[model samples]
Target: MNLDRSIDDYLAHVRTERGYSEHTVAAYRSDLVDLAGFASGRGVEGVAGIDLALLRDWLWTATERGLARTTIARRAASARGWTAWLHRRGLIAADPGLRLKAPRAQRTLPRVVAERALADALAALADRAAGDDPVAVRDAAIAELLYASALRVSELVGLDLADVDRRRRTVRVTGKGSKERVVPYGAPAARALDRYLEVARPAILAGVAEHGKNAGGAAAPTAVFLGVRGGRLGVRSVHRQIAAMLSSIPGAGPSGPHALRHSAATHLLDGGADLRAVQEFLGHASLGTTQIYTHVSAERLKQSYRTAHPRA
Candidate 1:
């Protein structure tokens, strides 16, 4: 079969059977497309033409082009998975990528804001939310819930009104793999959510009603977060909002919603939350993935000791 057709089938399998998120599937598609282009350039236009040596050369070319180690590593993984799938489906005589390898990507710790700094920042947002403005109210609630639950930005924006249980202080979120998990939020988030629901959400809905732009008559949006146009809030808009908020605060790291998540996880560990529980709270499938926060906590301890020990 053609390599491009095989790649499309693999992507469909991952998206439908494996239940990988849209973002993850897009990434895999991108990597495979790049490999297919390289293979076609070298007159290797079929699945049978891919071999261990060609795979190695592809990665070597990427390295020669000065791509980041992470990108190269992901490309290698994409190739490996695709070849394995082909072998399993009897589309290939053998798995050519069984011997494939790439340089390990460096693991940099996630950026975490100090507890005091985060507190001050949220407090300032809450103060701005004191008025009856809908956008300000929504922003405050978003910041509070993000820090309180350590939720991914996708999970946050995917939230619907029916998913939140204000009385229980819990939210039902569909995480990666379309897996549903109930995560609890703190008092600040609850308070902010309540205010937004009572004051801001209805106001926005009323605007939508006035404009007669409801997508469906009775089947209108039930999303917990809404844009200025009263449609479901999108991921890019959330990123932009978080970036604008983080730009003013003094911190080092990627200025996005994930910084709040990292800070929340690190804070939980510093407060003595168990590793296993934190893993569940963050909805991580693997314990190894959750172990990174321990390193963050240890690094914090070392920094404290360096500043206050004074025994040199």
Candidate 2:
């Protein structure tokens, strides 16, 4: 059968015989539709005539358009799954996408705030709080813990009544890929957190009412940060606040919550922390992923070299 005919038959089979949900069927349909467009652009008319080279060419075309590495990887997986289904059903007799490799994009070095500038931003938060805003107090604690432990904003907000150990100065964090790691902070972060828990959390929750999102509680049970509505703090609010604060500081390139995580990693490496130890602390799945921070160090070296080398 031709590509379009085979896809129509596969959709029906998956929905009725395989008991696939409508959403799953829809996703499959969309992926196949895009694949068909890609194949047409390659001058291949049907599934039976498709080859692995055509699949590679399609992905190369996407790379030329600057599709992110993760996006290209997902598209490649989608194509492989479709071709495998076609082969199993005898529509194409083989899977052409099996050998098509997604192009690997280089990992860019993460942008980080300079140590002095990051410290200054935290100091500025105290003035933001002295104006008698509980939300400002909460914001200080939120930003402090985020940078202190390199915590993803979600992990920071997801805490319950039992995640933090004040005595140990540590937090139990659930990281990406469902992995758990404990991260430590220092006295400064601890003091910021203590102030929030004692003074700010109650005030923010007091004006709020019960809702599905009020999972944290009226008294900020265990969340290191709480939304104005007594719910878990969300990524957007934290991001906006951080951006506004960081952009005011020199040496922090534009701003985002992620800058805190990057700054923390880079500073640790600069302070003579072992790369392998930093890898585990950052909870990187691969050491290669953690190695990008070395580039930041190299950039700093180049700056110092240009200034100090005596050769014009």
Candidate 3:
């Protein structure tokens, strides 16, 4: 088969069979395209002529060009995937990418909001938005639920009218792999959600007035969190709003939706939640991914012990 054909088919397999997301597949496609072009320049005609040396040369060239370690690693993974597929399909005798070493990347721990500070920030948000206005009510609910549930910004915004169970204090979240999980929210978030459903949603949705006045008085269907134009909440909108609101709040370091998620997991661990439970709560497929927070908690505990223990 041709070089392009081999690359395209391999990417398709990664996406469909490997269950990779579109963003991941797009990155893979781009990286492999670069590898293909570079291999061509090195007089490597196709999969038949590709070798480990060519892969190493491409990675070396990439590093020399000052690509970030993360990008270099991703590109290497893309090349490795392509080679493995080619070998598996009998298009090549061996996988050239098998022995490739990815550049080491510094793994930064996820940022988390401090317990006291996160409360103060939420309190401040409530204080400032406490007018009986609908927008105020909605903003209050948004902040409360974001922390209480640790929803990904996407899952938070994608919520529907029926998705929340106020009584149960949980929401049905459809996560990656279309895996559905019911995540619990705190009582404070429940109160805010109740208020929003009772009062704020109607104002945002603008039921009867906006849709040309239905004969039966029905309105245009709306998403749970309406944008200014009364549409579904988008990721950027949530980021911008959360950033603006939380920027001045102390201890909400480098804040975003993920900060709340990290905080939720860390706090859970602090309160003696199991690693497996946190993993399922965060929707992480691998337990190892959820294990990072243990390190975060360990740091906190060590600092506390040093400061509090009287080493007389």
Q: Give the whole-model CA lDDT for all candidates, comma-separated.
A: 0.92, 0.80, 0.81
Clashing pairs in 3: none
Candidate 3 — what's its lDDT? 0.81
As a whole number from 0 to 100, the lDDT of residue 166 in candidate 1 is: 96
* Global lDDT of model 2: 0.80
- Model 1 score (lDDT): 0.92
Error of 2 at 305 (Å): 1.4
Clashing pairs in 1: none
Candidate 1 wrongly placed segments (more than 4 Å): 212-220
Instruction: Encode model 3's per-residue lDDT on 1-312: one tens digit a residue.
Output: 767888889878887888776667888889988988998887776679888888898999999999999899888888888888888899998887889999887677777777988898888878866776777777778888888887888788878878877777889887765567899998888888888888777766674357633444433354677654466667887887788766876662567777888889999999999999999898988999899999999988887899999981
Each candidate structure's count of clashing pairs: 0, 1, 0
TM-score-sorted candidate list, best first: 1, 3, 2
TM-score: the better of candidates 2 and 3: 3
Over 1-312, each residue of candidate 2 has an lDDT whose tens digit, in order, gives 677887788888777877655556777788677778888876767788778888887778878989889778777876887788888877777788778788665566778787888888899997797766899988888889889999877777777658888999998987764578988999988998888887888777666644444555554545667787776777789889998888776663547888898999999998999999999888888998888898898898788899999992
Query: Could you tell me which residue pairs clash in candidate 2?
Result: 160-222
Taking all chains together, each candidate's TM-score versus the true structure is 0.96, 0.74, 0.84
